[model samples]
Structure formats: C-alpha cells, structure tokens
Target: MSAADPTRSHGPGGVHPIARLPEEWEAYFEANGERAFRGAQVFRWIHQRGELDPAKMSDLSKAWRVRLSEEGLAPPFELVEVFRSRDGTRKLLLELVDGGRVECVLIPMSKESDEDDESPATSGSSAEPPTDRRRKMTLCISTQLGCAMGCVFCASGQAGLVRGLGAAEIAAQVLEARRHLDDGEVLSNLVYMGMGEPLHHYDETARSIRLLSHGEGAGFGLRRITVSTVGLVPGIRRLGEDFGGKVGLALSLHAPSDDVRQKIIPMNSRFGVRDLVQSLREYPLPRRRRITIEYTLISGVNDQPAHARALANLLRPLSVKINLIPMNVIDASSLAAPSDEGVERFRDLLVQAGYSCFLRRRRGDDVAAACGQLALAERLVRPSASS
Candidate 1:
C-alpha cells in the first residue's frame, strides 16, 4: 500500500483498544462482564510482552482469551519491512490499519567516552556512570505519515503533510520495534525525528508518551524519549507544562536568525528564534539535563563561522548542547551539504564558545537511514498521498 492514505483517526474521534490505559481497560472488562484484573492482564500481555494475539496469553482463562480474540486483540500496524544497515541500524516500515504507512529506526549507540571525546549518534538517552558498559540503541519513530513543517533539508517533509498518526499507531511503533531487538542489544532510547512534526499533533503525541511511559504499560522512561520539533512555541510550552519538562526537548534550529530560519524552515515565520529560546528558558528541564539544539549545516547557508558565532550568541543564555548535523543534501533541494572541514570549523567555534557540541554521525547511509530517505524515490514517483 502507499505510505499516505487519509483515514479516520482513533484519537478524540475514536479510541483504539491498543491506546487504552489499564484503568480504561478495567472499565472495559467490567462493562463486558469480565473481572477487573483482566484489564491489567491484557495490558501486560500487549505492552510488557508485546503479544497481540490473545490466544498466546497463557495466564488468561480459555474463555476470556477466546473472548479477547473475538474482540480483536491485534496489532494496530503490521511490520512490512526491515532494512538493516552495516552499522547495526534497522529501519522498520509499518503499515497502519487504514493502509497508511510510517517508519521507525533502531540505531545502536557508541560506547561511553571521555568528556572531551567525540560522542555517539545522538542517543536520546541520558548519561549514565562511565563504569556502566552496555549496548544501547535508540529508536527514532514517526508521529505522522508525512510532515507538515516543510523544512528545506528534511526528506520527510519533502512530500508535504499527509496525516497525523493516531495515539494507538504512535504507541504501537515501540511495541512492534521492541520485538525486533537483537540479543544483548538493549532498546534504551527514543527520538521522534522520523517522519513528522511531532508537536503539530500535540494531543495524540502527548497521549502516546503517557501511554508508553505508564509503569503498567511499556514503561518507557520519559527522560529517554526526545521529542524533536521545528519550534512550535505553544506546543513546546504545553509539553513542559504537561510533562513537567521531564520529556527531552530537541529543537531543529537549522538557522541562527529569523531571516535565515524563515528562508529554510517554513514554520519559523510563525515562531521566531527569540520566542523559541524564551520558551526553552522557561522549560523545567531536570537538573543535569540540557536541551538539545539540532543544527543542520547547509553549505553557504548556515555553515559559516559567522553563523556559528551568531548561533552561539543566540543560544548562550539557555542551558543547551548543540548537535551538529551535516546536511543530507538531496537532488530536489538547492541546498548543498557542508564540507567535512567546514563542519569541523563550525563545531570548533561552538566548542571554543564553551558549549558542549558534538557532530551527529550519520548511521545507516547504505539503507537510506535518515528520516524518510528510504521513501524519497517512491514519494517522488508518486507525489499523491493516494493509497
């Protein structure tokens, strides 16, 4: 099926059983003449064990299991493809109930390094003690099938917005992605940087977070999940207020000033740099955690040393670290990727200015690992979101 298919959502309009909380499920069981504890059992079976087939839930009674199966305890989406890169990155293409498709990526992180050493692919996970050595992977998931924030450099938004995924579809990505984990390699972090502007659909995005982080559910840590945005100020503030700023926030600040930002990030005209920085300052980011600033360096655009200085000056007041991403230049975009030497110079200036900065190494390039890259050809061939 095509990646984009307009369909009714299971959000405010409807609620999918996969998106239900334990209490909500408890009520559902009681309403259906079943025991209340069955709700928790069903939830554990789905979220904790990643078992969608009720018949496989060994603890549940035979009748209850049969009833649950009849009620359609099935996966919200099917895992259609798994493309693995040489560097251990896996991109999962998922087809939703209404024939809509999205992608999620699992990227293994570099082992812990010294403070002065270069860092790993931006693992959204927080820092642990250096003594701990474990293989960690971060899954980059999509909140929409296609994006609304048409950033100039992003492959995801190249095709424009299709539709925001429902909370069930959003939450299900993790449950499904977990099933593909390799032995001894842990799924430790999540970054919402795959195919959409997460904040554009704030309600469903927030609901998915709550659903994933609930102890009785997937129990994914809020701090480990980074929500990347293109500066939707109200949604950013609401995220801080709603989650008490526990959720990691990463801003796609590709340009230092409004003039440059407005030229590249179409949404920058709505939320200017000053206002976005002010919102970050107001955020209640936990003690030791810093807001991540994502800077995509495009040649002759935002990669000059002067631009770096301006970026440092603008973000100086806020507690933040910079992730320098060399632009993934595509044929469709007029922008060109910054030279390796130029990228290092930009990072040098940021480091000289006393900001913790790291170059975000591109993983899974062979597999078109970057967001929506795998779909780029297909999207171009069929621009229509028709299924």
Candidate 2:
C-alpha cells in the first residue's frame, strides 16, 4: 500500500477475457502474422465502442472479421442469476469463464419527466452530457474474490479472503455493466464499495484506476470513481500521493472508538483509528472532492448521540464528508436496521455541528444484494485462502 507493488501474475489459471485486452489482442494478431494495427482496431471495437460481435466491426476487413470469429473472441463472464427490485435496482450474478461467479449491481437514479435523456458513454471515454433530470447510476465493483479485512458486519468478509483480482478483471466489471444499458443511458459513477476492501488489493486496484481513466481504453475520469477502504493506512497514504488528484477515497470508519471498532473490525488492531484518521487528514485531496467517511450506524452499538459527537471530533481537522449507513440486516445477524428516525437523528447531529452528512438508503435487500449483503455463493465452491 506504501507505493509498493503487489505480487501479480497473468493471474491464476489462464488469462481472463475481461482482464487481457492487450495480451489477447496481441496474441491473436501475432498468431495470424497480421499487422499490429489490428490490435488497436479490435480494442476500439470491444472496449471503446462496447461492440460484442467481431462481425459488427465494419472498419475491419471482412477476412479479418472472419478470422476474428474463427478465433472465437467472445465476451467473458456469462449471465447466470439476475435479480431485479421493484424499485429499479438490478443485481447481476455473473459466471466467469473459469466457472467462478461475481456480482455487479446497477442502481438507477430517479429521473424527472422532461429530463429523461440517455447516451452511451464512449468505450474509453467517461464523458456524459449534463442533464438536469438524469438519474446517476452507480456501479459497484469488486477488487478481490473475497475480503481479507473481515469486518464482522459484512457478509462478504464472512468467507474470509480469496485472492486479489487483476487490473483487467476490475476494469472489466465497468465494461460489462455498459453492455446492459439501453443504448444511451450512461453509467454516471463507479464505486469500489462492492465486496472487497479495495486498498488491500493495492496494485491491481491502482492499475484498474489507470485503465478506467485512460482516454483510449475505458476512459472513466478518476473524478467519477471512488475507492473504499476499511482503514488500510499504508494504502491511504500511497493513494494520496500516487492518485492524489485523480480518484476519490472513501474509508469505512464504522466505529468512532477503537474499543468498539476492534470488536467489529479486526483490522482496527493493526491500523487503529488515530493512525487511520491522521493519514486521511494529511492525504492531499482534490479541489472539489472531499474524502468520504462511511460510518454504518448499528442500533445499540454505534448509533448513539455520544457516538456522533466522538465521530464529529475525530473528523474535525480534515476535508471530509460523512455518509451514515443504517445497519441493513445481514444474513449472519439479528440486528435490525436502525429505524428511519434513528438515521435522521444521527444526520441532524452531524449537520448541526457544521459537517456534511448524508444517509445511504439500502437497496436490493430482498435479493440479499444490498449494502453489507453481497456475499457471492461461490464462497462454497472456491478453495480456502491458505490452500
């Protein structure tokens, strides 16, 4: 996390289709003894334009297109189980080519009547025209198979850590999401708030950020993406220096006090709140972007008025925005989500203290796909971390 690169490979098994745009295209052209220019064309067709079929690429010669077909370049990650909420939230369970599955979600923003406009984001470009009424859809992506930082409240960490995903695998999640949009509807924002503690996967997460913002590739501006962490201090410092002005960082500061935090988050012992907040306070932030402090308010645990005061005191020095998330029910617990009134009380306390605060509403809870509920079923199929 201290600008030290993570140990990586072509990834275990073979090259994942989503993670290997460069290698696969290069390999294809090399095997056919074709000009290198073919790689660029095919890359644009797939990543930039979001074109699936090779035949759909009109710019490529018919023979080359036929060769592409014969090579069988198909989209990776098959759609298996899809869950739709009546409220317009959709959860997609995708089966990777190797038979492993991961979840991706699409949360539609509420659009007003006359402002119902949508446009496809160019493959590598994250540019979207402004609309007074367009809903901001956020795509949550995963960085690792399972999380290493096992926060007790999260189902995703229940299975423990699997392995980190490569940069391509991370970027592929965004690419795959684009396919489901109805032609012109653009994915407005992206969050690494999915399953894993992103900063722990250090190298790939940073590399994925570069790929997403690369104008010739995925092209999502760093400003539009936020990487969430469960208090990995080294990662916070590294990201501040390396990705300083590009991307936003969100810390999962669930509990304000160490005594309470350690019980809920095991990582707290290693990276305590004092150290974590100090790093966050010192981390260079972009002009308009403030670091988001995500706090999950548990009913009888950390939702008290005293807890709010402690939290406000903890974040006083830094440029921070607090996102209060009610403890939505997790399959492993008996904790009821804090009542609407409880959430309001916490928000009002932070606001009166002159801090920016917002409540994160739980979505797709019926399918166990809401916040704190994205535990993929593959946890049973995959091997243990030590294995």
Candidate 3:
C-alpha cells in the first residue's frame, strides 16, 4: 500500500479521506463532480483553522457539509486524558479509533526575561509591562503506539512495539495539543520526541510532516518541525532526501562509542556510531541550520568527562548543536541520570571543546512528561526482562 493511504477508509483507487493533500482533495472533488475550489476550502478549514466539524464550516453548502461529515473528516482520535504539570506543561493521552493509545505533550518555552533581571521593565518606572509575555509552546508528538527501538533507558520501548501510528493519528496530536494552549500563547514549534522513535515509522512520519507543513493546512513551516531518531541510518538519509533537510533533524546519540551506544540503543549494533556520523556529514542540511545532537547523559555511563570529550571529538566536524539531557529516570530501568554537578561538567567539556552544548532542563517530570518518560507508568517493566 502507498504511504499516502489514509488511516481507516479508502475511496476509489485507495485515496485516504483525511490524509489528502490539496491537489489530492481537488482530484477527489473533481471525481465527485464538484468544483476544484472545494478542495482548497476543505483543506483550509481543517489545516489553517483547526476546524474538523463540517457543520462548523460556514462557507460550504449544507449538502456538501453533510457529505463531508459523513465521510469522516473529523479527528481520528478521542482525548482520553490530560495530565498537567505544575510548570504549565500538559501531557495528552489520546485513544485512537482502533483503541490504541498514544501520548503527546505541550511544553512552553522559558521566558527570555526570566534569564536576567537587568531589563528596562525591571527598573520599576510607571511604564506598563508588555502584554505579550506569553511564551511560545512546542508540542512533542509520538509517531507510534509503542516503540520497537528498545532504547534501554526509555519507557516506551519497555513493552516492545505495538504498531505505528497513521498520518492522521500523528497529525491529530498537534490539533489536540493546540486545544490546550493558554491565551496569548501560540504553538510555535513541534518535536517528534515523544513516546516513539520517529524513524522506525518513516512513511507515516513523512506523511504527517507533509500534512503539518502544507500551506493550506496546519501551515507550519518546515523549519519549525524537528524529527528525532535513534540513529536509523537509512531513515536519516531518506528524510534528508525527501525534505532536502529543511525539516529539523535531531539524532539521539546517547553514547559516544559503539560499545556504549549499542548497550543503550540496541539499533546501534546494526548501524554503528561511525556510520551514523558519516550519515550526518552527508545530510543535506540547509546553510546556517545545524542538526541537533541529543545526548542523554546517564549516571556513571555516558556522563563522564571522558565520554563528553569523546562525543565532542566525534561531532567536531559536523555543523550541529548538542543538547545534553540528564536522563529522565524511568521505572523500567535502573539507569539513572547524572548528578547536577556531573551534567554541568559534561557540558563544560563540550563547550570548552568549541562545540555548542546546552544542558536541556528536565520538564514536566512531576507528570511523567519528560524525555523517555511517556509510557504508561503503571506498566513499566525492567529493561533486562523486556529485552
């Protein structure tokens, strides 16, 4: 089956109803004896405005609205539950029509003003503060129900793979996440860093990108989206080719060497660290845009100064920025994150080596919404047992 096939039903020639591009929608309308403009209208309603209810679309004729409603143009999943962190992060648990559940998270960016108190506004004159202090939010979306990557530190991979999500199911995460945004805030960025390794489900991930970046649809620019992978070489190369590297690519390189990497990320045995680095070198990244290197720092494992220096040496030639995530401790593994001092020293080594490295702050930990922490908390099993 073509990757473009929609999740549930297919019309003549296997065209998916909800996953159609504007051109595809145009063809569908043409086949149904309707004018081509209807395609663009429907696309705008769904993508631009986030309106899925046919009756709520005011411009379309009642007959067309009824037909569209009957065709199942609504969201593919129902919101099962939402867990909100004290820090304003919200983790959404959505249940697909087929009963498969996936989780997505809404993360608000830290305010720039909070970093320093030297701002003119802090001088306490009679000037009114800017009303637009609302922080931009980034949505972390999942591409599969459970993951097959089996990263030893991750909760999602503990249960093994259930199934990959469809394009509609993947894209609906953003729509669902948007509903939880606070007033004056906008969904500014998207990261496929939730529950699953995106590259494992390449086709659906690609299609979801198309739907999200379509001008008439979600209208998100390609640059604003980041797809995270656990060093799947073929998928990395394919994504670079398919999108010309316009979409942001983040590699989860937890360990510097193959031995350590394979211990944590099982996929590394097949595609080694050297091969992954070579692939990164060849990725068609646009000028001035750097691929993000996500290195999860585990206690006494990959968080030592020597490991940090090795990682720096490995990525020395690539145009990349490193995000040092002190591993989010999960029930499935005994693996623990490094101490704050250890994490800081690791970052210092990378920075001293002339690499741009930032220690990623742990977000939404109170609600189990941090990285590698999205799976059902109650069902988590030991990594040794799961493997």
What Cα-based lDDT does every candidate model obtain? Answer: 0.79, 0.70, 0.78
Query: What's the TM-score of every candidate structure?
Result: 0.89, 0.82, 0.89
Count of steric clashes across candidates, in order: 0, 6, 1
Residue-level lDDT of model 1, residues 1-387, one tens digit each, is 112212322423234567777887899889878889988988887777777787898988898777666554677777878999999999887776666667889888654212322222222233443323546778898888778788889887777877777777787788888777775556677788888899998988998888888888777778877899999999999999999999999999999999999989999888999999999999999887888999999999889999999999999888888899998877568889899999999999999999988898888888888888876644423224442
Better of 2 and 3 by TM-score: 3
Poorly placed runs, candidate 3 (over 4 Å): 1-13, 111-133, 371-375, 378-387
Which pairs, if any, clash in model 3? 47-217
Ranking by TM-score: 1, 3, 2
Candidate 2 structure quality by residue, lDDT tens digits, 259-368 = 98998899999999999988887888866568889999888888888889899999888888888888866667666677788889888999999997877766776666
lDDT, residue 170, candidate 3: 83
lDDT of 3 by residue, 1-387 (tens): 222323533444454556777898898889889999999998888776777788999998999888877777778878877899998899987776666667899887655312311111111112333535545677899887778889888888776777777777788788777778776666777889887788988887898899888877777788888899998999999999999989889999999999889889889889999999999999999898888899998998888888988898899889988888888887779998789999888889889999877777878888888654645763422222211
